[model samples]
Target: MTVQKTEWPDSLWRSTAEPLRDFPELQEDIETDLLIIGAGYTGLSTALHAADAIEQIVILDQAQPGWGCSGRNGGQVHGQWKPDLAALQRLYPGSQFDAFIKTLGDAVELVFDLVDQHQIDCQAQRAGSIIAGKGGKAVRYLTEWSKFWAETGADVRLLDKHASTDLIGTSHYDRSMFDRRGGSVQPLAYCQGLARACHERGVTIHGDSRAVRISQNGNSWRVFTAHGSVKCERLVLATNGYTDELWPGLAQTIVPVASMLTATAPLPDAVVSTLLPQRQPVAEYAGVPAYYRVDETNRLVFGWRGTVSGEIGSLNTAHLRSRAVRLFPQIA
Candidate 1:
């Protein structure tokens, strides 16, 4: 479907986000030195970083910047990915693995650095993030993970059972790992702020400019949209999960997975003050689905594995709400 007919999922991020900064639709054919597809965090960050270095840059999105996962993420920015370090090492050389490990820390730093450097009003809080582990395996992995990072000079530590439960306000997890370098942001707001920053830095960003086709045109590449087209010397495609038939086999490179999030009504100050006392985001590794956080407004949000069927909330809200109450009897 075209952007005009796209249906955006109803989300707390959307409900709470400030008005989105506007970007014009591509109305006329243009040429640029660089063209970026997808205005999500990657594309926006890429454009922002290259604005001064590259003379001309254009960015296009199907709907709007932050309209996808970048805006709807759990907003828990932690320094870990593909948690199996051994598997990663098995796949990459030692040097490559080391570089990758360093990249994780660099990633967290980059997020906050961008926020600070641009003064992005995205409700950023650098309080830190916690991963609460449940069973023995989860606990051990988290413990070792924390130790590994701590050994690398990161401000990370593992909390014992009592500390984990006390900090989480629940006696469910056996332990928790805390990394001071991690934090959360108003994800949608952050995406919007990034888009605005890129625009102000002389990058051309267009919403509703879905790329329908990409073809070579002489020495450059041409992108055709419903309303306009862009010719650029180089093209960067950052359309991850929502990748489509823009270029041959590009969509197959990524799998489309979905996660669902729910937010409670903002709790009273008394309740929020007691919960997440340090304001760190908390995620649980004990159950089927687990990441939770306190947004800038002190609303409790929980996420779980979601279905592409688009009925997770309709099907599971009751259970999720019950779990929420279970997590914090303060709500009940």
Candidate 2:
């Protein structure tokens, strides 16, 4: 028999991120208060919160910590995916919508607080985020969106065509909005920092430990692995998109969508000054949204929702490089 090892991309945060050296195999059976199945942001964040309350919590991951989307995300903490507040109000009526919005705002704050308290040197920046509109229809849509966000008491300022050009130094967009609420960070580094913090707080993190099968005992659950098993009172399935065969029906609900990104060698100071004068992260609304931001080293990193097919793998750098050049011809 042979074991296949998974590989991760060479992200910018790979060097500075906290390293989780291999852990010894689970030789004997173990019982814990909670068994978390995944080592990404959600799993680790849940572990960090539940660590103080429970007596024992075990986090199981097939790969290394932060090996999934948690480490590979665009790092921008934007508002809800559904931009329409009215639809949200109608769907989650009463105080639910308000509570949801408040919770999102709190989530943004919590990310920053964790970075600060744990002293995570993840290049966390709060310069802000921009949503630019490329054409006539897009400009009108952005205008409506600005008005809608304003009604919800969100701090967003609509930039006219001239103003948008002045800000971005590109005449491609007719208008835009600056959302001061959210910003960007080195996502992988942040995840690694959270994992380290959880470990320091006595959370048992098992890496390279894939949950092969799961069974239900009388009242509890047992997770079987290639090396060992974990018997626990409660189980949390935090493996988003990349969920395995251990949990039935859980994987069907989540569509494992793939996204692609590219990072250029640090841009010239002059080009940076013109493109992103304020150094704010910019994202445009398209069928596939175009997201780009300047990192701490002033490198332009861009990504978008990738076309899904059969298998997911590392994105093509040449394709992404061409896209970047298309967006900023001057850079080419």
Candidate 3:
């Protein structure tokens, strides 16, 4: 199905985001120094970064900017490598591993730095992030992880049960890790702001212009869309989970997984003051983990694994509400 027919999901991010000017559809053949497919964070950020150096840059998206995962994610700015640090050290040489780890550590700053430099209006917060561990394995990992980060002179620490309860307003977790570098944002707004920043920098962006095909044109690359085409010296495919078969086997390399998020009605000021007072986003690790945070409007946005069948609210996320209530009886 074409992106024109897909509707925006009913999400809190959508309802809360300020209006963004829409980019026009591609209507004519064009040539550029760089052509990027997908206007999500990757493509937008790439364009913004290259705007000063590269003279001509063009970006195309299937739908409006941030219509994909960039808009609908949990918004938690987790500032660490997903893989185990020890495992990653074993996989790469010392120099490469050091560079990778440094990048991972500075990832959060890269995001906030962009937001600050561009004056993005996204509801960005840099309070911190908490990873609460319930069982023995999770606790041990947090303990070691905290020590590693602290040894690097990072503002990170492991909290006991009492301290965890005091910080998170919940007593369910056995121990928790707090990293001052992590935070959250209005993800959709951030994406749109990035798009606006790139556009203002003379980067051409076309929404509803899905890259249907691509081929080599001599030393350059040519991209075909429904109503237009682009010839560029270089092409970038930044479609993450929504990757299609534009490049034959490219889509097969990615395994698609779904996540669902639900938000509570805005709580009273009294209740909000007691919950996540420092505004740190929180995650709990048991078996199936859950991540949650307080939004700008004082609503609790809770997220977890979603069904593979592509279901939305109702039965698919009823258990999510129950679990959220279980964590904070005040919400009930």
Among all candidates shown, the one with the greatest lDDT: 3
Full ranking by TM-score = 3, 1, 2
**Which residues of candidate 3, in runs, are more than 4 Å off?**
1-6, 306-315
State the local distance difference test value for candidate 1: 0.83
Give the whole-model CA lDDT for all candidates, comma-separated: 0.83, 0.79, 0.86
Question: Which residue pairs in candidate 2 have backbone atoms (N, alpha carbon, C) closer than 3 angstroms, thus clashing?
Answer: none
Supply the global lDDT for candidate 3: 0.86
Instruction: Score every model by TM-score.
Output: 0.93, 0.90, 0.94
- The residue ranges of model 1 lying beyond 4 angstroms of the native Cα positions read 1-10, 307-315
Measured over all alpha carbons after superposition, the RMSD of each candidate to the real structure, in angstroms, is 2.5, 2.6, 2.4
- lDDT per residue for candidate 3 within 1-332, as digits (tens), equals 33363368788888888877678888789999999999999999999988878999999998889999999988888766544567778887789987877887788899999999999999999999998888888888888888988998989999999999999998989999899999998999999999989988999999888889898968999999888899999888999988878989998888655677889999999898878989899876555578899998999999886444445434356788998989888988
| Candidate 2 structure quality by residue, lDDT tens digits, 1-332 | 45545567677767546565654445557999899989899999999999879979999888878888888878877653435555677887998877887787778789988999889878888876788877776676677767866787888779987988887767777788877777888999898888888889898988877888999989899998887899999999999878756678876777656677778888898788778777677888665566888887878888866645524454577777877787678777
